[model samples]
Target: MALRIPKAELPLEVRENMVQQLGAVPENVEVTWHSPKVAQDDMEFGGEVGAWDAADASLKSFAQMAVPALVG
Candidate 1:
């Protein structure tokens, strides 16, 4: 059987998209916080800060959804 994933563990954009498309996540779904630090770290050494900026943008979009904790 397939295990359901948590909405919070998903990328903010992905969670937003899911909310837009599926209305809601099922009750059995697990959840976790999405840390922006992780996003920044992944992009910090990419020769420039563009990746980090993009990650921030994603977090901003998530903030609009009232899920600011998604950023950490």
Candidate 2:
């Protein structure tokens, strides 16, 4: 599973702190920093949904995309 956190809202120092507190970072986890313009473009192209909703939609889309790869 992937986790997306808005870097602008939570700075890198905070994220590093959390990682340090956690003691271990999973291999499956990814941290991405989205620029304001790129983020806006993503929302506009996808749907105008709230964060959680957009995340759900993205996950669903990823799962669907993965089906063929998994089968082949």
Candidate 3:
């Protein structure tokens, strides 16, 4: 039988912030947030890592999306 995963619920404020920034809560954010402390730290770290502006935005987005698929 296939396993069923439960839906993630973010705090109302966090949900609103994520939606405002991304247009929706990304599945990656939900999955990465399985633990509150880890999720908080991960999101903060992701913000820091995502702030480098030298690279072209389009290229960086493509690379970020591609690397995970390639690795997996």
Per-structure clash totals for the candidates: 1, 0, 0
Candidate 2: C-alpha RMSD to true structure equals: 11.7
Q: How many angstroms is residue 72 displaced in model 1 relative to the true structure, after the best TM-score fit?
A: 66
Give candidate 2's error at residue 27 in angstroms: 18
Best by TM-score: 3
Per-prediction TM-score to the true structure, in the order listed: 0.26, 0.25, 0.58
Model 1 spans with C-alpha error above 4 angstroms: 1-8, 27-72
Better of 1 and 2 by TM-score: 1
Full-model lDDT for every candidate: 0.52, 0.52, 0.81
lDDT of 3 by residue, 1-72 (tens): 432555578889999999999999987667656687888898889999899769777888899999999999
Using lDDT as the yardstick, the better of models 1 and 3 is: 3
TM-score of 2: 0.25
- lDDT of model 3 at position 11: 86
Model 2, span 4-63: residue lDDT tens:
553244356645864896665322232223464554465355444443344456688889
Q: Candidate 2: list runs displaced more than 4 Å.
A: 1-6, 10-33, 48-72
